[model samples]
Target chain A: MTERAVCVIGTGLIGGSLMRAAEKAGRAVWGTSASEDTAAEARADGFDVTTDTDDALRRAADADALVVLAVPLPVLPEVLRRVDAVAPEVRLTDAVSVKVAVADAVARYAPRARYVGGHPMAGTSESGWSAGLAELFVDAAWVVAADDGLDLDVWRDVAELAWACGARVVPAAADEHDLAVARVSHLPHLLAAVLAAVGAGGDDALPLALAAGSFADGTRVAGTRPELVLAMCEGNRDALLGAVDDALGRLGAMRGALASTGGLTATVFAGHAGRERWAASRDPKGVKVSLKGRAPLAALRAVGRRGAVVSGWKA
Target chain B: MTERAVCVIGTGLIGGSLMRAAEKAGRAVWGTSASEDTAAEARADGFDVTTDTDDALRRAADADALVVLAVPLPVLPEVLRRVDAVAPEVRLTDAVSVKVAVADAVARYAPRARYVGGHPMAGTSESGWSAGLAELFVDAAWVVAADDGLDLDVWRDVAELAWACGARVVPAAADEHDLAVARVSHLPHLLAAVLAAVGAGGDDALPLALAAGSFADGTRVAGTRPELVLAMCEGNRDALLGAVDDALGRLGAMRGALASTGGLTATVFAGHAGRERWAASRDPKGVKVSLKGRAPLAALRAVGRRGAVVSGWKA
Candidate 1:
């Protein structure tokens, strides 16, 4: 059988990781980088890399070829315009962290192309091609936009690509995806950033120096690129604001309970119970993976677990 | 030189870990558990354990002997009273999360005993004796209360014990330790709890299921024992409240910036810079470790690094 051809634009962390996953899936993969240096690096790394997005899309304009627009949210509209003008026949997808904004951009600028809005739930604080790892998406959930009018074949191919990356595909509408991430992803970033700032507010370095595992783990994400975090938060501003309000209400209630009762009541105990329950409910056995041949460091293991990359679980 | 004898009350996670660390440090250690089952478990696990705290303290009442009170903050006063009546001659210390309250309790009930307040900055979410490890405090900072009127010999002995347990002794006054932990530790706990509660507040399980590494990392502390979290927060009420306000103010400003300017400006960039600077400035070489003999996992390592238990750093 002929392997599927895939093209990824913007060879940053997410895009580069996706290209690596596509290669792992035995697909003919191509990628484009905004910086010539990064493009050269990707080529040196044995990837078909290009400096121009239009030229890259032109190469992927073959029958049934998939074009993944993996740029940041702010640049999505312009890229959509370019794709519409250059290669509207190519089936398109996205890997932006924010979904609704990208979906809107796609509807406005690339209405002629068959598009599937997607977000691969994977990343480290580091960015760019240098930070990309082949095992990044292993056991992670890749969200596919299951909006009305999205072609069934396009959705299936996207799911196949996610599986190729050793990721489980979760189907959600654009709005649902945005809101879910706002609560879980975006809200946590804001909290960590604020916590980091507060820790530094004090003059003596004892607080930071004496910080152990909890503080390190808690503030790790706050060290990510500020511009990227800001863009993701602003792109999903409404959902993020609502999440912040919810969090504030919860914090205020806890403070009130502490003041009035001097202890956490069963009301606050629910958080502990809920978190444990949620943690236990994660089933690593949900994905069925079978290796086609002897693959290097490939596995169906969940993301963040050791040896997950070498587990080599393939659908 | 003969090994320094140490006794630990309340053989839970922290206490059990201390006992294990003391044993590794070549100290003759004894432990007491609140329940017969825990005492039996401790004995079965090769610890010198008993159900009577008073009896255990009486056995360790020799001159220069140290007793570590590792009970929860709410129960600390009662434990101090028992220690005073049974072993007033034993140099007493504690491993509570909050310091000011513990210091106050020691002053009130165990005034005759030479006392020091100590808090080891290490723990996993799991609790009880079963989770104890010999290396739990390795490479971790153990805060020794540097309050006025503390006996010089008592302080030296306590610092010696901290170094024995593969920990770096960080000298901090009661209030300073309380305030620093309030910002870095207690406030983060409240944020995690609220974030967990808010994430679970939504009816859809999708948000909870889709929670990735950042959400999981940020909220890891929320899964800790709720009552313990409450006690820590309430024990350092003033500082935690102040931290809460500071955090809320920072969060509010960020939300307003996103709403008004539609992007993160330099103001928000402080968090990123502060987090990075904090991460980069960590000096693993700050602690100087010297081992008298070959420890089982002996290596020149910083606390929190791999195999820190045998590093055996003395300050």
Candidate 2:
């Protein structure tokens, strides 16, 4: 069998990191950099880098295994057009956060794009080539959204990439993927940023100095790439907006219950149990972890005893 | 002057920790335990412990400093009654999370209690005598809320104790303190718990194993003593609710902005800067520190640079 060629478009954090790791796994890797600077950096990091997006398409066409669109949402439509003109016979896919927008774009730009929509829910506050790491996507979720009757072989290859990068592959449709992120991904960032702004609002700003790690951790996502998040929110606005409203309602009810005797009291225990379960579980890649609360770090092994499906904890 | 005798009520995480820290700081420490077992354990940990709240109050009545009502919100009234009847002359205070409730409870039950409301805003997920650590309160905030005309000496003593634990001191009205916490402290726990529950609710339930450090850090406070958190939420229900509403509204705005081209992009940057600062600033606290988006493992000089008060460098 000819060597499996994997072309990754947009060599920033996610793309660059996966390319480095893919090269290590012995895959023939090709990447397109929108700028000469990025192309130089990607080449310096030991991968074939191209400035012409079509060269990437040709290299990834008919003879290859996977073509990953790892660009931002705003540029996806243009890239999809280029891929269509060149790689119509190839197994194609994307690493965009908003699957619905990208999927729609693919339909309009390249109806037979042979592409699947996906989001690797992993990143740091850093960006650019420097943010790339061999284990960047390890143990995170790589949500794969494909239509009916898609090629099973392509799915297998993409899933392998997910597995190789230590990410768990979860299957969802475009809208389903959109909603899940609104809840788990996008909402958290918004809360953190606003609270920080509020905390920083007072005279003397001393209250902020006392804000501590809990404040930072809870608001960690707020500091994510603004352009990226803004793009995501735009692409998945209604679902994300609904989640915000739903969360607010819950927060309001939490307050109402706190005022009543039998109220917030009942909910507190449920929160405790939920947190316990959250802490006991490992990352999707199966690494042991401790959430903010201490779950008797000694008894974490008992998580499996509690019927936790921890992946690497298989005794 | 002779060493001022101080009685620390409750022999759990906060109380026991205070007692140990106080003893090390040269205060004559007397501890009140909720039960005989805890009292015995407190004694074993080298503090003077008593099972009778009234008798201990009577015996320690002549003392200068009194840490009162070593109980959650529900039992505070009774503890105040005992303190009023037995130690009426001593300067009194508490280590509760919600300040207004403690102030109100003391005012209602022990009007002459000479009480100033306090919250150390420092702790770990551990409880009991075994969890006692003299260094726990170091460099944390020892917030004091007292009437303007109240004896500065009294507030000074409490501040001294907080400082002895290596904490910085902040002053506010009891009501203001509660509102501040409701916004920064209480709301985060609820939000984290909400997120945790959402993660826990998935069909495969593998989100638990997929729960990473971020999930753990974010949800850690939710797993805090449910009764304790319930007390805080219950005590400051209105403010906490307001905070929740505000948080949700902001989160919604952020989601909307993420989905659109405009909305609080600078706020997000400021938040990230503020959070990074909080994790990096130094207030010389011995409190267990955590961060949302960053690690709190920098040198002691860099412990808490997250607030707006500290200047942020735009990245």
Candidate 3:
């Protein structure tokens, strides 16, 4: 099968990396950045990039290429408006961190577009075009939304793009993907923030000096740019709130056990078990779901729910 | 100055590492392990290791060596009892994680011992003699207790040992050290446990599949052995409880803000600032505290409070 051309909007770390990876995988790829400096940097690095959003969308529409919105949540509305104006019915997906927000924005702003939400579970704390790596998505999980009544053709295209970029596809429903990411990604960001703040404790040198591996690992994500963290976390408010409540409940029980009995056996053992479960799931057996089958979305969601990755499509 | 002979109790990761590092620094070193298997393993590796705690203490007494307690908190009192029986007045120190518990144990079991408590802030998740690294303490902070009425001579001896092991000394009171570690070390363990459990969410495969760098890093310490985590966290119950309360409060406030306004700006920014503070203090300026001064303890504590490391000491 011939690879579909990819047009990536907002050429930051994830987008820029995707453009590079997709092109390297033999797909025609071009991208745009809102920042002229970033676009010029990418261009200087021998990639086709521009700062004109409308022109990029027009090219995508003319070629019937897959249009990927890679902008942060705060800028999604404006980007969608341009997509709606130039390519209202284009094959669409995104590399945004949250799915439900992006899907909802698509529904409101670009209703006619054939959109399937996506988030590649990969990144570094660093950002901008200069930080882009063509190998960034290698061996990573790229989540593609599998809600009912979606265009299977566009869905397969998105999964193919993920595969081409060296990532395995994990198909899940939009709302389910949001909740799962809220638990695993968004909640950890908040916890890291809290841990960092508590470790700092008004900039007390003694505590920071005594901090070692655990503290460093626990707070590593807290070093991410604050605005980016706020955008994704606040964008997934409902799901994140549920995750936060769940975390707080567990913490409260842990504190009660510690204060009363001075025993963290339950908490520690449960966590050990949890970590073991994760370790066991790291190399899940591969599965395939036919996109042409009846209830394909259900099959995809089941594959994701079982922690299995779609190694390849069964046409 | 001639290096003092050192006797280490317990041959686990920290203890075994200390034995190797001290010997490399030209100090006469021998160690005892409660587990005969571990003692045999160390002995086979060409080190002076024995399972006979009484004999080791007798030798330490004969050599006027520094008796270093490197056992877990659960086994600390038993070790102290052996110390009292064989070498009640020996120059003593410890590499325990919790300072107050070990100090209290020494006070109860070996009151006449000239003890200056110490804890090297370095380790790996792995345990046992095979996991020990001679370079573990290199460029790490080793906290030595500086409470009022501590024997300055013994304190200097402990600092010298730390220096010889390639660590910089950070002098803090026993209570202060406990509190600081409670915030940085013990509390991070608990938080990691909670985060791991929440991410696992009753062994749901979806969340674990979606987990990425943040979740992995935030729960990295939860991969540690549960019993070890329970021992240190429970041993410092009072201080850990306070830190847990502080974390719970911040999480609660974050949840409130997230739920009510869907804004996490405050939490995100605070955490970013805290991470910046840690980064700024990473390469702290060097300062020296004279052991011969009238208020040397006071000077050491002040240096620690300002996050200044002891580069060297003045006689």
Identify the candidate with maximal DockQ.
3
Per-candidate alpha-carbon RMSD to the true structure: 7.9, 9.4, 1.4
Off by over 4 Å in 1: A1-3, A266-268, A284-315, B1-3, B266-268, B284-315
Best by lDDT: 3
For each candidate, the DockQ is 0.30, 0.26, 0.86
Lowest lDDT 10-residue stretch of candidate 3 chain A: A201-210
TM-scores (chain A) of the candidates: 0.87, 0.84, 0.97
Which docking category, incorrect, acceptable, medium or high, applies to candidate 1? acceptable
TM-scores vs. true structure, each candidate: 0.87, 0.83, 0.98
- Name the docking class for model 2: acceptable
- Candidate 2 structure quality by residue, lDDT tens digits, A21-57: 7787778888888999989877786678979989778
Cα shift from native, residue B158, model 1 (Å) = 0.4
Assess candidate 1 and give its TM-score to the true structure.
0.87
* lDDT of the candidates, in the order given: 0.77, 0.67, 0.90
**For model 1, how does the per-residue alpha-carbon lDDT over A169-238 read when each residue is reduced to its tens digit?**
7667778778889998998888888888887777666677667776777888888888888888878988
